[model samples]
Target: MEVSYREEGVASAASSVAGRLVADGVPARLAGGDPTLWGEDAEAEAAVRLGWLTLPRSSRELLPALGELAARTRAAGLTNVVLAGMGGSSLAAEIICATGDVPLTVLDTTDPGQVRRALTDRLESTVVVVASKSGSTVETDCHLRIYQRLFADAGLDPAGRVVVVTDPGSPLEQLAADGGHELVLAPPDVGGRYSALSAFGLVPAALAGADVAGLLDEAAEVLPLLSLDTGNPGLDLGAALGGAALAGRDKLLLEDQLSPIFGLPDWIEQLVAESTGKQGRGILPVVGADPNRSGDELVVAIESDVGDVRVDGPLGAQFLVWEYATAVAGLLLEVDPFDQPQVAESKENTTALLALPDLPTGAPAFTDGPVEVYGAATAKDLPGLFAELLHAIPGDGYLAIMAYLDRLAAFDAPVPEGADFEQMTDAWMMADPLTLRTLLALRTDRPVTFGWGPRFLHSTGQYHKGGPQNGVFLQITGVVTEDVAVPGRPYSLGRLQLAQALGDLAALETRGRPAVRLHLTDRAAGVARLLAAAQEA
Candidate 1:
């Protein structure tokens, strides 16, 4: 594809950024608690900064081991692999398989429907890759417990079928050790978002039949170009983006007009959002969004050289390219690209919420009505309130739907599994957001985003609270009629889910963000009704 800036003055800035890359005299200073870049010293920032500098070499070093494991997986006759993770731990593997060439399904969402689907999938032969850098991510841990129970109930040995990816001493590392699960330790310096080239992404790629060696080689081949003082593709990209964002084009629309691996933008969105989305400024990377491109937007298209784009080049190489570019943008923005100060607030709030004895007992901030009517009230109720919120967006602002509803849990309401599962549910539950993105983009000259709660809390939540204050958030919460109890935790899945939703609302309110919360009577049906009403409206 093509990569160009829609804003002016970026070319000169690219040169300046290239110069800064060399002149800083700290090309590799990040790994050693260097603070000259951001002029701050925090343990978290210092420890996580070196991944991009050394991950390429680490990947090259680990090639043989990865290949061996790939052979073992093939011998095991695994036809499909399912990855259970969140945000950084999951996004890279997603890109590795986004072309649909990789026989993999990434279970990154906590939607019960998605989890149940994973539970019922080809468990007899499917390989399970449990990836998480933090080792103790709430979602990953809970998912592991769920799968562990399932494996036990089915008389299957999870350790023989599972692999663990994490740092050397993280909780998952210990879990793998305690359970005899295959383990791949990521380089300790690498942050989750930067761990793609590390075993995190490589193992999955190797298992998926991608040339892991070629990917690393391609990544190494680009090092010379990326380190250059001028005309470096990756460095220049950083300059263009950083320069443009500083010039008020902060909404980066990352498009691949001709790539089969179109989901590359999803990974990039997290990289850009989490890295630079702090200090009251950040790049809002748009993935799969192609409507109402505004004047304040910068479009960066990643396409193939000639025909329709596929993952022809080493994906590992592209990962480094984007990492370098995003780091450069962070430098230009004067924000620490390594630390997420706001992400912890949601987690802490969720934890506090989990300790509670019951769900929030107060009335919802707003409710349309009892969601009993199937066609009229069931549909019109949500859309009516949504329209009010949509109309209230500030000038040059975007609309964000923070859906805290149990997307798949409630929908599992005794419906015939095969006769209507595919037809009854929106394809992948994506229609609601895609439809809203289309409608909201038309209704207002601004972008529209749909974030499933708690999941996005780890991905884009930092941007919502700590980045630019230009979002009009609409929250959808529902009664969790059915719930799954975390095996050991004091609370149930329904409680954890609602805590995350309410915790997010608290975080938003803590930031004084403009928001509206609607408590729905039914989780899955409410979303369907909302979409239907929007269509009719």
Candidate 2:
């Protein structure tokens, strides 16, 4: 838990940004921007509302309250913990669970099979925690309704089993209060992405028996070290990277030495993309990617803790540091750090898609076996098709590989002999996608990024739909060979997976993104083909 702090490269790199913030009156003005310091203001109201500045102080309350709820779960003998939230709400806890001894299952995907699997297997012994800032996130709400019915069918009172984390006056709080579910109020000012240190993350961490107080202590150590005038580590970093982006080094390439904590990169992606990406200006986050080939990128190498993820050391400190850095980056870029104007476009489109009386048949404009193409039609022509897509990217453009598939850590099913590595590569590609991303970024002149389905929808989904139009989306979809059935539901998990995919596609196309849908029959082979095509291009 004692994470070593390497101040060598980071300190030098961050100096310029810190200097610029001072010159721009950024440090002094940030006080005006933060609601914690000056109440609500028109300029940075939304950004300031999210829990960045106040988290250290608020953690004192969150730790004890979350501990009490978690203790309740333990007293009730609830061993299985399932968290239902998307993007920022779930990412930090995902990392914590992965790094610590906590066994918290995150249900962030809309992949029906996974959802059914999570809810059906251990309903009697599980405690379902719904974390959402607005208390009205579409996925969280949809999931809560299903779980509510599942609990009802199991003859268990859903009220006693469910817990919620949201702002005081949000619908989520009302639901928890009215239904008798455990209600944990996140700081009213904190937004979704910035709520990691707030109840949104702590409740789950505490449920998993993580050291909530220790984490706050670690954060406390770093909080005072982040002031702009003092040239502290966090401020130095915030200015360095944020200033670089404003000067056209906009692709923030993140290389991960942080294993078992792969969540860090994704966490940073949401922080950077959602916060700084806006108004035709943004930092395109490249996570777990070592393009090893750099072009207009500011490479950030993260050397994570050598031991298990714990709050005793720099692990907890890192979050506060990055959060502060992101806010400062926003200040330097002259953009509101907290507001997400474009994130709503995709949500509205998804709602519209989900509401249609009859879903449209997703017939392809181009066909190739199980690999049907909506635009690029033939297998032999795929490499060129992809190359053309890559070629079309502007100097400032970026590439996003959006895959819809099961991202299991290990494949239990049998595979073709000598295909285990390839199959595993296929699976890991969906989860991390760093190897493939590095390959693509190296081959092209643009920054490359990747994420699993429904998962990224909650993270980079907003930037993809709302940020600069300078993005090319390569959406990968495949048929689920196996399916998990949701009892009493008309459709199986396989059907639901396709529904979410189609809905997202509709959302993307409606937004005018230059995107392509590649259909594959076999998940492994298809992903392999996509990789081959990207490299060939």
Candidate 3:
């Protein structure tokens, strides 16, 4: 199987990198194909073969470490497990513990409140596992510092309590040695995001009581199955998908349930988005719970468990099958199935924002005067209350009005230049709609900016802290029953706690900045009322 190199320069660079990897004893291979050849390429087939061959064969080597940690957790009686890291380093552990029925809490966000809540809300006997290949991820470091302070405040020993995972001679390993903490070294050459199947992800998965061994074995079996040929399911799928995407079909949809494959979609998103998104063309990868309905394009589902035969018969199968499908899709695109360009920028931006002392101010505030009231009460007479607020704030008072859910996407707009006011507003709008509306109401007639969402919030959350601040913040909170729970664990209240902490952090972000807190009993109804009031205002 072979892929043609398009731009000679790019091909040369790729070859140089591949050659270096080979010199370093890494099994490096180049898959190439012509961009104009549509679907005719051996690169896709090669990718499929390689992907299958690369799967881990066993998790037995990690079992001992996992057992030790689990025993420590049980012995120490820790109730919360904070896995600190970013990208693949953090995502794997988070997804496993968050999706599993574990008796511990997993905090994934970089928000101060998230760290605070993880430290303060749970029992003092919480255990922290800091995972990072480089050990210098700013967010992970910030979180480690926060945890250190909490440990100090609690008067607990840091050594033997916290675990640091990284390369053998990496700074993280050095820190762990100096701090007297347990150290788990990832393979030397393993990248941070790709280290999950290694000790990087194993420790947390085992601690969370997931079938880590099973997962690894499953992955190992998959490795040999992927080859750079149309006959290889993985490569074929990748090629077909990539071809479709290049052919102007920009949306790649993964059914629900398969969403928790953890970093899989993200991996694909980075691959497709970065590889194909250049030159004025890119696919918009979207993964979500398939509204249980389908139309137009083809649908394929893979099973999550092992020995699940992947039959392209029906539209949906299981998680493993879906992974195979992802591999195939990558082949079709003739691009490396891994790597993310914006990830480093994301970390850099977050670190820079954290280091900045002058947090943006002067944007609108939610309230002009002191707001002393705080309650978890649901609003009554929604329509009537909205009418009252509308009457209180008259004509053209609202520049933009969006529902709490809808406001999440408002920040998708590029930040304007020079106008600090617009930049801050965009940030606030993207952060929380409740905050944006309150600010708009307080400042009356300042062109409001915002968007709506369920997915938008996740996209813009990183930008809210990393980007320039330009707007007011109002965090909306409400109690909602658990609609879904990971099997076999304690009640899945972690999400609620996570949401509350996220909102709290957003509120605490600025001092003397306009912000409001509206606690509702019926979240859906409250959001409706908030939207109605915004429209009326």
Candidate 4:
């Protein structure tokens, strides 16, 4: 693994921070699994969270079992692998499978169309891997129940079709045991964001025919270098990230210029944003973000070639090193990286909204074509609404486009038979949210970030609420053409998705952050009108 910073200011700041860390013996202490680095308040959580520090070595024990499971599933003719998980549980697997060039369907949203898409196709040869770190995540639980119901409805035994990965005593374990499903327990000491090397990440990837053993080997080669004071990429990268954030360049614009590992930036977004974006300070990661040479942003290229700050390595080593770097960044920021204090607020709000006799319907400022615009009470048209959202951005702040619609449907075209999902997703034509993101970035100098609804609720949600109050949010929701039920749950997937959007909006509003919601009465037509208006504006 190699980490380099070419900019003189960044190099100077990083060197200063690194020199301080060397004097404090931080590199060796972190490698030795010392939990007191974050001080007394964080010691308890850090003690357990530091397990990731040794995961490159200790996780070798899981290979044989994961290999056997993969072999058995393949022998049973289950070629279609779907991972139903959320946040850390799902992001790592998504990246691993994508990088390994394997086909793995990832279900990380409550969008009904997406759920229906996963269910209707490849039913006979499918194997669903249910992963949840705490086993109590509402989205994961909803997916599990829906899958079980659908499988039974199709005359398939749910027991043989479902496999679970979670902590030992989590509720999912008991549920898995009750249903006679195979259970893989992750390390109790490792937190979800830090479980990339544990069973949570490896199980689904392995089942989908990824190079699991090779990943472990790559990570092992990088392990010994992390403990040394000199030539430690993890320490150097951490210092650079922490120092840059402290220097008012907290908005990280990450580009995958030539990285072979697909979806790596998304994984880094979750790890860094959630780990350090707390206590009124943190790094805000913008994946696939445009270059903003402005004083407020830092561009890091995740490529094998070049950048101001470049990180290049094998996939496995990349995972370990980034995790180490995040932990180190957290120490520099004086925040507990392991704890996501504000993440549960939206969840709690969603539950309350769902329990209501009817979901709360707020009054919209105006209706333009098929879209209902809310917030900025003065806006009367789509262009006016777009202008209002742009006008809300603070000088040093950013604009976040949060789409609660189906990500696949937004960015992807229909794939031809035998065509790859990645290829379809990268097709020439762009969709509503992507077009809006591009237009908005072109319209402003501030950093712009686009996130899929409930997924970002897990990734950057913490940062939006807990980190800085300078964010201006634009949330988009649409009508669900065909809503899917969550079996035992009262709310449908469509309702849960809206509730999540509303809940997140409520959180941001409570924080006094400038936010607006554009409701699409007709998903296709509404987005078209909005984008056209944006173009005209």
What tens-digit string does per-residue lDDT give for candidate 2 at 29-67?
A: 553344332224324575546456668667787666677
How many pairs of residues collide in each model?
A: 2, 5, 58, 0
| Model 1: per-residue Cα lDDT over 1-537, one tens digit each | 113443345556555665766688534443223556665554446555666666666678777887788788889887578787888877777777765466677777655655667778887777788888879888888888888888888998888788898888888988999999999888888788877787888776677776667667767777666655554556667777887787777877666777655478778878888888887899887665664656666667665432111223346667877887777788889888888899999889888887777756464433444443211122235666556667767665667877765444544444445756676554544335335556556566677777767667776788888898878787766666556666776776667777887788788877666666666576555655666666655
- How well does each candidate superpose onto the true structure, as a TM-score? 0.87, 0.85, 0.55, 0.96
Total backbone clashes of candidate 2, pairs 3 or more residues apart or in separate chains: 5
> Between the candidate structures 3 and 4, which one is better when assessed by TM-score?
4
Residue 529 lDDT (model 1): 64
* Alpha-carbon lDDT of model 1: 0.70
lDDT of 3: 0.44
Residue 323 lDDT (model 3): 45
Q: Residue 432 in model 4: shift from native, Å?
A: 4.0
| Model 1 regions more than 4 Å off | 1-9, 12-35, 42-44, 291-293, 304-314, 365-384, 405-431, 478-482, 535-537
Q: State how far residue 508 of model 2 sits from its true place (Å).
A: 4.4
Instruction: Enumerate residue pairs that collide in model 4.
Output: none
Per-residue lDDT tens digits for candidate 4, residues 1-537, read: 899997988899899899999999999999999999999999999998888877878888988988898889899888999999988999998999998889999999999988888999899899999999899999899999998988899998988889999998999999999999999999999988888889988999999999888888889999998998999999999999998888888888888868898988898999999998898999999876677688878778887444569898999999999999999999999999999999999999999999998888688888999999877557778887778778888988999999998876765444557767665654423454667888878888888898998999898999999898899999999998899988888889999999999999999999888888999998877777877898876
